[model samples]
Target: MRLKERTIAIVLGGGKGTRLYPLTMDRAKPAVPFAGKYRLVDIPISNCINSGIRQIYILTQFNSASLHNHISNTYIFDTFSNGFVEILAAEQTNQTDTWYQGTADAVRKNLKHFHDQNADYYIILSGDQLYRMDLKDMLDRHIACGAELTIATKPISREQATGLGIIGCDSEGIITKFYEKPANDLDISEYKVADSLLHASLGKHVDASNEYLASMGIYIFNAKTMEEVLNNDKTDFGKEIIPDVIKQRKVATYLFDGFWEDIGTIKAFYETNLDLASINPQFNFYNEMMPIYTHRRHLPATKVNFCNISSSLTSEGSIITNAYIVNSIIGVRTIIESGASLDGVYCMGASFYETEVEKTANAKKGIPNIGIGRGTIIRKAIIDQNARIGDGCRIGIDDIPRQEGDFAMYSIHDGIIVINKNAVIKNGTVM
Candidate 1:
């Protein structure tokens, strides 16, 4: 299929990210620093650029300064004269009087820019996901099928399908039935039946019951379809818009059987990062054939000492001393204290636990001292940027339930906890 004329994409980066808790408490969801080196926004933006789609716009809302700054500094390149990235912050015009309410509304609020550019296709993606997809292929399929809207679909586990936007399609890959979250098991089963109409394996169709698919929240909208839907909607793209459009429009489904993960929650975010550190990760970001682009901060290669480290992606200037890091990621300019222990953890850029904390209270809730006497041990945790850990603190290792104190404690879906920046703890505190 021939490429559509002048395609433009808008990445939604405005979510508050409350599920990420303390880490996102200060920044927007997309601006949240992730996996030691890059922000959450980097993944989607990188995906867009790598997929050969430029002229991208990132929509931002809460704490957009850091997100905007990172995008401007990192994503600016001189390769293409016509390629550029822009941020569309939530603002009120003389007509409307509030911040963006939802994803559809955000796009609707900025309809003028999209219309002015006269883009034929509008690709919409969330910034809080960790998946690498060649949107060009999806766009090709969309054009070939003459679809008003094309959605990226991925097969998901039956038990886990309840949380996502479940979809159903016809034999020609035209979506027919769509549900945000179906309640009854029989209805979900029926939805799966409807999905089977389009997703048959050509030579194999009997085992189609196991072939359940859900929307990835990635959409390619034919300009006219987008103009009509957003112009007539008040709810979100999935919850309100797409469900109604599929009934009246020629909506198609693009099947993708690769690794696609939504890292919207703390547990999912943490687990996906650890997945990158696996010996044979399900999601291979290091694939030389399809590497995920970043801001390209130039620094020296990481130095590994007698530390037992493996399967982890270490950015530049990360000094791993006589510590044990397994299946974890270390970000740029990070200094791992000597004799520290880490496993299945994600340490953001330049984080160092302070060596000073008054042991006035029982070794609990607050930051734990991180020296030899403090005895720090971390397991399945995420330490945000520039955090200083004291001498002796145990995180996720010992079976100590988190307690409330001066420092905050957040539990993600994968049980990976988050430590805020510059949080001070006394000696021998248990997390």
Candidate 2:
């Protein structure tokens, strides 16, 4: 049972990832790079493709140029196939003259696009999330139970439920209550899902410690239900739309016991990246069945002359000479000079290399070429794409430095020490 022809996935690239700070400084959150080889948007998009849901629409309003470029360059379907990865950028027209105000508003404005496709059901996805799910299975359950709306939910601890879209369902997997990030003291006794329902929903995959279900922000709606529900003035989903329809509609929850993380904030993003470097990573990049796709750089294998890299991922076209990198992700086209030490860092390598003439000009201006400098020590930091690290410089807790102010042209995020894209650093600098 495939929903390929009847389902069209809509991936919402949420407005400028304000929580992600420097990473979102110049690009949309979904466009932000992840796991050394792919962008955050690739997760949901890849999931859609792997599930045979190839007709994807990405909606973005903030810094969408980069996102557009990535999508355009990467996804190209054959002439006979109707499959495509298109971007519906927010626009102003005679009907309206404003940007997308919220999630519901964004889709409300673009309803015409989906209406033309006439898909029976629409799957809504978050572009900046990390997970792999088969929509066919979830849709199978949704259709079997005749649910008007279905939410993909994961079991979470009581403490973790306080900051998410908390769900409460009955014994038959039918939702009875929806709480959008309830306060710690909020009473939720009557809304809690029955233990039998949860155990039956997951069966052998049940976790005894998971007492609450948290929404993954992935919603599947019947086409008519979408039209009737979104034809309102509501601006958001978690805040307005879901709450308004739960009682009047047949809502249900689909249990997902996979590794899912919302990479919305800087801390969450940093932690998630570092987790990829763990020995037994929760989210493995080497999944052959459902591999995450990305724009191919077509570069050669990385060259390490005398560097020591352990539990780290180094992408293509990187050159590390006599350096030590531990538990980090070195992005594509990175060049780490001799004697540098990096620990728990995510270095988003340069997008392109500088020509010899460009390097000479950069040297004249006393700026380091796009990579870590000789003898530089960095730990627990994120180096954005095309960043330069000067020689003999120390970053991230080397001198017990908590200063977050810009060092040269770099920006800091909650002491994570981020060097923004295409920024430069001077020699012997410490932060």
Candidate 3:
């Protein structure tokens, strides 16, 4: 059978994104908006589609309404193609009534749904990540090595290894050991990559700082091997299944040299979004060969009138007038009134446009409309969907040191102010 026909991809929709709070307050981690228009889940799904692997299933649990809607509207396969992008949500059954305990458990519960796929290999992916990779290469390596399990690993420095699962591999690329998040005092020098392995992967001598191999949480398993490993009650792959299988099975590692960032925390998400507006970003979403796909709103073109914007990405259906925006992402349906200024901000625009009557009514009630008001100045902040920033407001631009915690209508995380969805910031407010 062909590679596309014999492989199935299962994307794990992450648990309640507590770290990405307010953003995840109303949606699943995978459903959270990304870049200017795409969702976090779109990255992996688009990678699958671009790589000719359309037999995809997303496993979701928490706040999956928006996720389900997005998948249904975005990824639709024709009957002739026999390709599909399906969702396998957590449900109650005779076997169990509890939610997904962990990553492994989520797949284990849905094994019955995948029994009819007849795929030779199952590729597991994380939904909340940013990277573009041809998964075919990893599967090819797995077949060439005759390995039951192949893990995608990234070379990282010692400083980056503290919070990630580190793997130890021999010269032949066989994983010898696995350590999950070793502490500062722990001696994991033995797990460092050998010079021979580093040269084989990168084709050059890399600095000793990038010695450790951190698991990218991307895995491909032989169909039978996946069943065998999930027979137990192991809840997590990185913590339990992977470490146990390395000893009993042939587990290999595939080195990924491309840029990959785990959008786990709010700070990481913020920085990653802002980086996309740079002159040259590490992760390019503009690749024609493997373009990232998302919901097609078919909205009108953005209307920028007398705006001094620099190095920013503005999506469709936006109207900016006499504003100064720099190094920011203006999302769909955004409206920036005259005299507004934004710097290093990600404004997730309104979901639905308000009519003139509605805006007038809101104004009479002393409420800001669903957009950035005139004379507002926001810096280093995330304006969520449908947020109403009143006139003359100053957010994140003040020199006052704000503690990292949730406040009324907004929160401070890593020095970035995040205005909640549909939050109403009164006029002349300063933060």
Candidate 4:
């Protein structure tokens, strides 16, 4: 059978992305707006489609309304084609009555749907990571090695290995042992990879530190092996299943040297979004051969009058007048009035334009417009969708507000202010 037809992808949409708070308040983490317009889920979905793997399933739970909306609105396949991108939510059954306990349990509970399909292999991916990869290349390695399961690994520093699944490998690039977040003094030098293995898997060595091989949380399973593994009561792949399998099965590693970010925390998400606006971005989204695919908004082009924008991205249907924006990302339907200044911010913009009647009613209610107001100064902040920042407000201008906690209206993390979705900043407010 052809390789393309023998595989299907399963994207694990995480449960309650609490790490990305306020952003995940109204929508699932995967549905949270990313890179100004695209959702976090689009990264893996676009990779799968571009890699010629069309048949897919997205397993999601916890506030999936916006996620379901985005998926349904986008990704329409041919009428007669077998290709599909389906969303699978956890449900109660005669045997089980609870939600998914972990990533492996999520797949184990849904294995019934996949059981009927005759695919040879299953590709597992995370929905909230940023990377561009062709799964076909990893699949070829799995098939060639005759591996029952293959994990994609990347070289990481000693400090980074404390929170990830670190793999121990042999000279032939076969998995030998697995460690989940080992302590600093545990001595993981036994797993130090050979130069030949690094050169063969990735074109070059990515880390000069070369302390450990961190799993990218990407997995490819031989269909039969997954059936055998999931038959047991193991709850999570990283903490339980993978460690057990490496000791018994034919497992290999596929190294990826490219840019990959796990946008799991508010700090990570905020920093990663701003990474796109850099002169030489760590992760480039402008690859002509494989651009990131997203739901087309069909909104009109961005409009600007006497605005000064540099090193920023403004999405469609935005109206900017007499605003100075630098090193920021303005999302769809955003409106920036005159005398406003934004620097090093990520504005998700409004969900929808407020009608004239709605505006009049809002005025009566004393609510501000769904965008930046006149004479406001915003710096190093994240303005969530449909946020109302009133006139003459000062956000992160003089006070960094460096914090690791959340307030009722917003959060200040790593010296950057994050305005929650649908939140209101009163007129003349100073934050």
Candidate 5:
């Protein structure tokens, strides 16, 4: 089938991110606020639209309202054309009366919808990733190679390759060995070092230059292949589906040598946002052409008071009160209280003023009713909307080394904190 004639691509947005606790408490992983103003879901959908694939169906389960609302408002399908982007929420069908079990299971449950659309191919993707790729390129490669399935692969460090579905492909790009999160071993050959401090500077201990390819959780499957697998599946694509197909030796590797960051973990999620603040961003969000689309909050220009602001993205409706903000991302309607200091923080909209002052005071005494706090300093922290911080709390914990604890925390490769929405920190507490 030609790439343009492909039926539709299914984006899996149903994962109830338990890992991103406080943030996923009220919204799905895809709906979680990211960078300064956008949600995690925007990356994939924007990629799809820009890649010339408009017929999309997002599979959703937990906290689907926010996801649904965002998709509807931001992505209005063209009325004149047959192509459309839609959301497939869980419903009680005749074949099943339960919620989706996993990634593969979710699609299997909704096979009836796909049948109605009559798509020629199925492009399956993960919603929780930060990358800019041309999907059309992958589709073209898949068709040209005449393969039943084409999986996306990217090179990663051996130490960071543990949790991924690693693969060893032959010279012709046919995958030879497949391991889902293999144990540490000297089984594979390493790459030669350039010896320069820039290339080989992870200390001499990083001797092995093994070029292991990790699955980016993106796939292009023929419709027949999808139907066959889904009809005979009880497991997910990552854990069971892909591995099972690869075992048949019919899957080909589509090597994606480009910038890709998986926001599946807390740490990765935090680091991706901070990367946007860098002087030369790894991912450029400001690209007017082929821009990453998000629901425009239509917020007025951020009001700045007597504050020291530098290298930050302060979205509309954010009020910088006599505070100092450096290398941070503040979302819509966010008010940084007087005397507060924000460094390397991603803050969303929320304030104690949303509710009765006494109600907020009961939870965290001395916290400002206006929102955020006075004399509070945040470093490498993620603050969700409407969280009230007391007068003297330090939001980010970069000063001290990273620590694992009871309060739900998400950190990326680089040590950065991910604060989810509506998360309350008790007054005087240091995270």
Candidate 6:
């Protein structure tokens, strides 16, 4: 059988993404909007599809309604392809009734469902990451090395290795030692990649600063090996299973020097989204050969009227009128009235447009409409979906320092103001 036929992909929908806070308040991390259009889950699924792996399963637990809806509406296969993208949510069973404690536990609970496929290899992926990787290359390397388990690793600077799992490998790419998030003062030169290996993978002119090989948390394992490893009581792969398995198994490393970002924290999520609007973003969503897939809302094209938008991305079904937006992202169904100014902002637009009657009713009640009102200036902020900003509002524009914490209607995290979803700001309000 071909690689696509014998390989099954398992995407682990992350636990309550507390670091991403308000964005994950009502939805799972994978369901959170990304790049003004796609969800975080789309990146992994799209990569799998592009690599010809169609038998996929996404294990979800917390706030999965939106995720289920998106998957149902978007990834449908024909009758004869034997391709399916299914969700295996945590549930009560004869074996266990608790929620998923960690990534390994999530997969172990769903192994019965996975076994129906009778696949040869299992590729495990994370849901809340942004990257475009061809897994076929990783799988080919796994087979060529005659390895039981393979991990995808990336070369990073020593400063970046403190928070990541560092791996030690020989020149032949066989993993020898693994360290989980070593302390800053600890001496971990033993975990550093050989300079010659770096030269082979990243070219001889590679930066001398990047000597550590950090695990990318992307793994490929033989089907029986996965079953054998999960037979233990380990709850997480990185913290428990990987470190133990390296000493006993033939674990190899696949060097990946592509652009990959772990969108686990609010700051990383915000910065990564804004970077997509750059002229030459590190992660390109416009690659025609490996297109990212998402829900097709059948919305009309975005309509802009005399708006000065530069270095920004505007999604479909948006209507902008005489707004000054720069270095920002305007999401779907967004409406900006005249004289509104936005800089370094990500406005996640409304889900539905308010009709004339509804707008008039809200006006009588002294409430702002569903979109940004006139003459509002916002900078370095994130406006969540269905937010209402009244006229003459100033958000994140002043030089005043705001405390970092969750407030009634919004949050200030990492010096960036995030207006909560469905929040309403009165006219002449200043932040």
The model with the greatest lDDT is 3
lDDT of 1 by residue, 62-108 (tens): 88887777888887768744677889998878998888899999999
Against the true structure, what is each candidate's TM-score? 0.87, 0.97, 0.97, 0.97, 0.85, 0.98
Candidate 5 lDDT over residue span 291-346, tens digit each? 99888666678889999988888877777789988888887778777898988788
- How well is each residue in 272-357 modelled by candidate 6, as lDDT tens digits? 99999999999988899999998889999999999899999999999999999999999999999999999999998978889999
C-alpha lDDT values of all predictions: 0.75, 0.88, 0.93, 0.89, 0.74, 0.92
Off by over 4 Å in 1: 1-5, 193-209, 351-375, 403-415
lDDT of the structure predicted as candidate 2: 0.88
Worst 10 residues of 3 by lDDT: 199-208
Cα lDDT of candidate 6 equals 0.92
lDDT per residue, candidate 3, 262-317, as tens digits?
98889999999999999999999888999999999999999999999999999999
lDDT of 2 by residue, 54-77 (tens): 889999988888999999999888
Q: Per-residue lDDT tens digits of candidate 4, residues 1-431?
A: 67877898999999888888878888888899999889999999999989999889999888999989999989888976577888999899999999989999999998899876689999999988999998999999999999999999988888888888899898888999998898988888877888778877677545678657899999999999998998888889989999999999999999887888999888898889988987788998889899888898889999999999998989899999999999999999999999999999999988799999988899899999889999999998999999999999999887444566789889876666899999999889988
Error of 4 at 237 (Å): 0.6
Consecutive 10-residue window with the lowest summed lDDT within model 4: 397-406
Candidate 3 Cα outliers beyond 4 Å, as residue runs:
204-208
RMSD to true structure for each model, in Å: 4.5, 1.5, 1.3, 1.5, 5.6, 1.2
lDDT of 1: 0.75
Q: What is the TM-score ranking, best to worst? A: 6, 3, 2, 4, 1, 5
Worst 10 residues of 1 by lDDT: 366-375
Candidate 5, overall lDDT? 0.74
